[model samples]
Target: MMVDGVVARLRELDGELAPGDGVAVFNGMYLAVTEEVRDRLAGGRFDDPAAVAELDVLFAGRYLAAVAADQAGRRPAACWRPLFTARRQPGVHPVQFALAGISAHVEHDLPLAVVDTCRSRRCPPQQLSADYHRINDVLADLEARVREQLMPGPDPLEAADPLTHLVGCWSLDRARDAAWASAQALWALHRLPPAYAALATALDESVGAVCRRLLTPLVRRRSGGGQDQGGQDQLECSGLPSA
Candidate 1:
């Protein structure tokens, strides 16, 4: 799909789902990221705008395709399995959900997207490395904003808070670095079909596991009988455990 079409689909999603819904959380962040890339393309931020645009659309398409597959009762990539499975769970925070989506996209889909773009453009992975890193820069900026918007406010034990612990465990910088490595590795395996398949499968599973861990329920204690706005279950409605 074209960039405009992708943006429109995301906007429709943003309007359809609840603001704090797990998928919606990630969708909103992704929408912003895509829009930024679009702006950069128009501003001549990159040496090869066409290549960048192709990579961006292909990257977003992986996400959109996964959503469509999941809705059609087909399983998405292993890396996307976690978000699709836990998106509606009662204990996962919206931020965690968003981070989990980001993890899968960056860690698993990105390397594959790189390969796909190279095939479409008839170029090597190295040719796209600059654009890849440029997209990474955009994602990193959005990551910071997601953290700031979704993270809990300061509290006495905030440093020791479970949510804080969860966020600290996952690093976008590390994911981006790993993606670059994977892209290079895939580039090398391009001529070895069997080896390429093996590595791709391994990458998908490993990234999926990371996403699953990121989405783990981090319930702060509560006294109530139900989940809160962000789908977090709480018994006391605060940090203290249930009486």
Candidate 2:
């Protein structure tokens, strides 16, 4: 599947979902990032655009598969369950949704995608490292922009805000580094089907746990306990439970 195909699917999803839906929020952010990647690939920014394109498809396929499964009333990949479960919840901030999706995609799907790309291309994970990092560059940019757009109010960290905790806990750099390590591990276990499957399952579940933490709450309580949009709250979901 071309990256354009991934962009199209995401666009369709964005169109289908309500503006405030958590999945839609994440999907919208992802679509923008994918579009940027597609443009860069078309412009010859990557060293090996074909390999990166293949990886992009495989990476996105995992998320799309989860979406399909959920839509079909089946369980999505565990890593994706948090966002989907919280999709209609009243409290989750858009930044939280976006970061949780990022967590699921980067920590769990990325390694598997990298390994799949390697097996399909008959190349080592090392061969794909440069392009992989290049793509990470794009995601890094998205993370920064997301923080600014969604939490652009007072300095979250300086204000001792609860949202500071939620968004602060997720590190794209760490996630990407761990993903590369996982890809190497998955590649090394190519001949060990049972082990590979076990690692994959563990990864899926663990990433789900991480996302659960990220989507915990976004707003902090005000001094007088009055609620306002983007106002302070004990970091409850603004209107939902903090826990």
Candidate 3:
């Protein structure tokens, strides 16, 4: 239930930050939390439940503080503020988008890790073990379904939905490799405490950008070969950079 605890804490924070100011805040918080967890795990500190709890508290507190500042019309106070603000708006709430992205990442790893750890425990609770196994099974099935939907076909337009295609591509096991590679690039650019700041920032920005590109109509038009004068005018109107 280690990952369950993490997910629970994230949900609690999400609830606290309801009516989110925008995706930037949520991205910042999610990156902060996950990077904390990842670092702790990498450092072997997550073996102790108490340590994990402490980490959760620290992350939750920091995220809440940032959210409060955001709500007050003050800039977020952190190294990643510029990256977060790149896509955020003054009034748009990003809570749901952030939660979804974070949840997807968690779903991709945490539950499976919890199940494995529980199975290896000397005196694991049977009920908890069973619950984790079920969760893992369900996730596997869902991933398989998503893969089936994403398999390339003769008609390229059949996979025109970029959001679905992106999700499917990243659902593969190799997505972790991509994420790690990207994190490494970020690390090279901006070193931070515990060597995790860059990794977290990278994940937050990459995920946020992907979501915006996939879900925003402005992005879709640019990708759909709409390069006529009207399309150019629309692009200028939207203030998006040229493709």
Candidate 4:
């Protein structure tokens, strides 16, 4: 199994991707595997390293195939979707079990992290605890590295905060576009808009700050003029968040 630091870092990086983006899809799979390990650890189902490796391969294969399908513009194959879907049945393929196990694990972990973070009055809604942040940073760095490897773009590490890069791509207008959808879903799932409202407020405030900070730097970096590069260097040397 991957170490906790590695797993946390992966989550941080993957979280930057728009939901359903290919990188996010792969991250989701790995998250599921980590969740399974957490669950077994909790329930006393500890397995040997060989068994863990087998599980990893199974989940990775399913995740990769799903990403490929998504890139090809097809609905995810049934195998790639969450296991609790009505189509799934008992005694399914071993891969199905692995997927199901991992899904449950991730589901549990998210709420736990959110709740823990929320409980810490000092913690920001959008950021995890320091250790968690470190783990997340590692994950974000890894994802950026992978993207650089495959896409060969400018230095993601230097250009902007990956989380901000992600949020900038998802502007307030985009979030507001789905406001109705989000309200309806939250109402149906949680039977409460008050909590959702609070989260929405926090998200709006955070996104607004992110937008202003990211805009000028983003424009400068993309403009690719020598002048912009100089400005960017000045901004960096000033040691202030972009604005």
Candidate 5:
């Protein structure tokens, strides 16, 4: 239901924003992932397509809710705070925006979605682990594609490159590992009054902080306000000051 609706919302966003817009870049990547999942569900890729659909809807709801909150001038969850605020900033790269959104969604929102799905389906967390892992695999594949398509390059491994440092620091693999742990913890604490909420809040705040750091602007230097790198022309920021 809601998962079906999310695809429409993402398409609306894609049409409204420019290609280079930070939010638009990330939304496009996310839209790809969501559509892939939608196809997988329709093709019966999972043991319980209905349950997987529920989880996907709940997971996407968190992101949609944050966008709504930001539009309304209200505070969104901590994990979403960075992407929402930095998405339109001039110096922030589209790759950074995409990764930051992924960080927030996977690290903070996903585990909670898993728990919620389990509760809704009257099942244990373990029962949903297969679907969870399958979804993660999808994300992992998409991340590689995103980097190939969106990353500005001078070879990310080049020494003394700021982008290299940023790339090294942000990893979806690590985030997914933490999310799985959080899901287990949340399931374990499900019946404990207040504790579950507190843990979830802590997870949200911690992931948000990571996203904030990831969105931190790196110095962009190029001539004539743009440059060709890795066979693609990119608009880059400028300026330098001596120490």
Candidate 6:
């Protein structure tokens, strides 16, 4: 139903975004991955297409809400603030912005989305596990492409690079596993509204801490206007600064 049309709205938003903004870098990659997921779901690759589609929509709404909040001069979620605040810092690599956005979305919004979808669909978290993991599989596949395309140079990232450590700190597989656990935890705590709310607050704050580190400015800018082939102005590794 709305699944086929969802990409249109994301495309429109991507078009409206300013070039070189950190959010734009992440949103652009997200748009591509969303397109891929939409295509696979439409092609009937998922075990429960309807369930996955609904989950996808619920998950996307969080990111859309953050963007709206920032545009309206309200503070977005703590997890998203790093990307929004550091968008034009000139020293942060685009990949850091992209990963930070993913970290915020997956670590914070994703578990809540899973719980919300379960409540809306009148099912337990276990019922959605099959298709939930399927969607994550899609995300994991696209993440490699996102990193390859957004790395600040034509050369592959060196093994000893500091950026390697930054990227490694947020592993996609581990993030997915943790998100599922959180979803199950939230679902269990839902009947205790106060407990649910407290855990949710903690989740938001903790994920924000991780994302803030991921978005920490990782490079030094050139004194002149020299630019890399990646079109970024980053010149060399600057020690990680306090975010």
lDDT of 2 by residue, 127-197 (tens): 98888999999999999988888874755454546676668878999999999999999999988999999
Ranking by TM-score: 2, 1, 6, 5, 3, 4
Per-residue lDDT of candidate 3, residues 1-243 (tens digit): 344455565566556643543444444455444544545445664335543344334434444454567668786443223323533443112332343333334322232233233334423333333333333343344345434442334424533344344344344244434433443344343424555554454455555444443223223234344666433221111332111
Worst 10 residues of 1 by lDDT: 234-243
lDDT of 6 by residue, 1-243 (tens): 265556776787889988888898888878887888888987888887888888888888889889999999998988788788888876687888889889889988999999998988899999988888888888898789877777646544442266666677778888999999999999999999999999999999888888878876665444444555433343455544343
Worst 10 residues of 4 by lDDT: 234-243
Error of 2 at 122 (Å): 0.4
Candidate 4 pairs with clashing backbones: 9-139, 10-139, 13-140
Residue pairs with colliding backbones in model 3 are 22-94, 23-94
- Lowest summed-lDDT stretch of 10 residues in model 2? 234-243
What local lDDT does model 4 show for residue 166?
Answer: 36
> Better model by lDDT, 3 or 4?
3
TM-score of 1: 0.88
Ranking by lDDT: 2, 1, 5, 6, 3, 4
- Candidate 4 C-alpha lDDT tens digits along 1-243: 343544565576467656534345446546644555544444544334323333333334444454557557775433233322211232122222232323322222223233333333333333322233333333344344333443314445555444234323532223322333333333343335587556544533443343223222122232344764653421121221221
Report the lDDT of model 5 for residue 208. Answer: 86
lDDT of the structure predicted as candidate 2: 0.86
The TM-score that candidate 6 achieves is 0.87
Better of 2 and 4 by lDDT: 2
- Model 1 lDDT per residue over 1-243, tens place: 777788899999899877657888899999999999989999988978998888888888889998899889999988888888877777677788889999999998888888988989899989987777888889999999999888867543632376777779999999999998998899889889999999999999999888888887765563334455434333221222110
Best by TM-score: 2
- RMSD of candidate 6 to the truth, in angstroms, is 4.6
**lDDT scores in order:** 0.83, 0.86, 0.40, 0.37, 0.81, 0.81
Which portions of model 3 miss their true places by more than 4 Å?
1-46, 77-96, 99-160, 168-243
Candidate 5, poorest ten consecutive residues by summed lDDT: 234-243
